[model samples]
Target: MISGVLISTLKAQQASVLQLRNWRTLNLRRTVVSPRIAHLRHRHLRQKSIPVAANIISEFRKANVRCTPSGEKIFKQAYAKAPANTFSCSWELYSPLWTTIRGEDTPDSLCYRNLNVSSARQWRSRQAYDICISFKVYKVWEALYTNSNIFRQLIDDQEKDCRDFSRCCMALQPLWLWLKLVVKEGLVERGDVDQLPEPSMLRDVVIGSGDPPDAVDLGLVNPAMCH
Candidate 1:
């Protein structure tokens, strides 16, 4: 009876050892496999996102727009007056510039055509307004583009705020449209587009003061507002 009991005890200890070894093997496999799976998932996501970002950037480069010398000067002056933390030009800066550009003594509201004044007096043509706003938009973009560090920061901020790279790219659409309008209005010559800042230098800017909650809309140059 004693011999049998001792044998039984020895078998039980051996079984426990085997069970522990099997458990360790299983745990070790999980530890190794989980991270490999995670790495592959991360790489797959990165691969998927790269093309979308590349396409957006490629499309943006196709705008082929540049700021006029006068526009560049104006942007420089405005940038100088802006706060150090200012990432984009504001309407406060643009408004005064517009007034100066218009050379009008009229109230700001009237100058912007916000008032429903009598039609008896001649007003600026819609095309004229379009050109003016488009010029301003082009200059703002040029200013940002020339300052590559700020431009990249602006894009990075937009990406963080939206948490979507595509949406960050979309924020640039209004600027692109306004740029195309600048080209359409003959403000920028086709030859000048070739001289635009490098594609890597491109970035987005708000046409007005304060950062919006999401993407930067058309601001003063909204199509509906233009019409």
Candidate 2:
């Protein structure tokens, strides 16, 4: 009887040890696999969204510029004497305005170099006036989306939130700026701007719905959210 009781006790201890070992192995697997699964999920979503985003951008590029209410107001104010039925500004003229705005001198150089008309007759020319008004209106629109403070915060947060995704965010910045410009200019609807996919973690911050206090202060939030 003593030998049998000893054998039974030994078997019970062995079973407890095995159970503990199995639990630890299961936990270890979970620890290792969880992050990998998360990373793969992120990559999958990004891949799926890319082609859709590219198509949207391609369509936006092909679409002609149509002034929003704000853009129309800008146009009328800039060309009060011109006929109401004036045609949309040609892309040839509009394209150079972006280059000028991105330049170091910016509005100063834009004003003095392109818009400095020596006479009222020079100002009266539609081509010259188009350049001036387009620059002025776009400059204002650029500030709305590219607030220096908000952009700096975006970079900082991108590094903190996900270092791996930072490079992707940097690459997308120019495209984002272009999208914002078209939206503000009334060339594209705010709904269209919302279709561009961003990383799940950074989407709120980029679109101005995140915890960044500066976004609200600077009015850097995407206009779509307000509606």
Candidate 3:
């Protein structure tokens, strides 16, 4: 009876040891697997941002804005102004520079228009606004492309903002139609119109009962707006 009892006790101890070994193996595997998963996620994000970065660069280039070495210098200088982690990407840090350039009353103010001289004269052309704004927003993307850590966050932010921009443009459907008519009829000057057609102008053309909303082609609003 004593010998039987000893054998059973030894068997139980061996089983416990085997169970512990299996648990440790699983833990080791998880530790190794977790990092591999994270690396793959990072790679996917980088791949996605590459094209986005290229598109952004192309947009700026259309406006004759260069984002190579000079832009890099500007980016680094501006980066110091923002607090740590305040900006997800360097582009966010560099955005203020573009805005500052826009507000300044310098030759470069119209420089955004230099991309196409003819388009510059046409304030009614949505392309002009897009070209100009692209130049302004280029610095942020340029910086983002240079930094991998922040680039992932930038892709997420841009995706979310894209939806917002689309929604906002859609909500302005009524105004969009009005602007089209204004542009078509030349009521709004092709040049010299710095902002949206005056609210009063929109009210007069659409609400005055002289012309119905259907009179204007909504397709003229440039589906995306000048974002």
Please provide, for model 1 over 79-163, each residue's C-alpha lDDT reduced to its tens digit, 9 standing for 90 to 100: 4444443435332333434444445232212233543533652446877755544554455455445544434455444445444
The segments of candidate 2 whose C-alpha lies over 4 angstroms from its true place after superposition are 49-227
Give per-model TM-scores: 0.27, 0.24, 0.32
Q: Which ten-residue region of model 1 has the weakest summed lDDT?
A: 51-60
Deviation of model 2 at 75, angstroms: 26
**80-102, model 3: which lDDT tens digit per residue?**
35445434453443354455333
- Which has the better lDDT: candidate 2, or candidate 3? 3
- Clashing residue pairs, candidate 2? none
Q: Higher TM-score: candidate 1 or 2? A: 1
The lDDT of model 1 is 0.46
Instruction: Give per-candidate clash totals.
Output: 0, 0, 2
**Model 1 pairs in collision:** none
Runs of candidate 1 exceeding 4 Å displacement: 1-67, 76-80, 88-147, 162-192, 195-227
Model 2 Cα lDDT, one tens digit per residue, 6-118? 99999999999999999999999999999999999999877555432233333333332233444333333333433322212222223432443344232212232354523
Query: Can you rank all candidates by lDDT, best first?
Result: 1, 3, 2
Model 2 scores worst on lDDT over the 10 consecutive residues at: 84-93
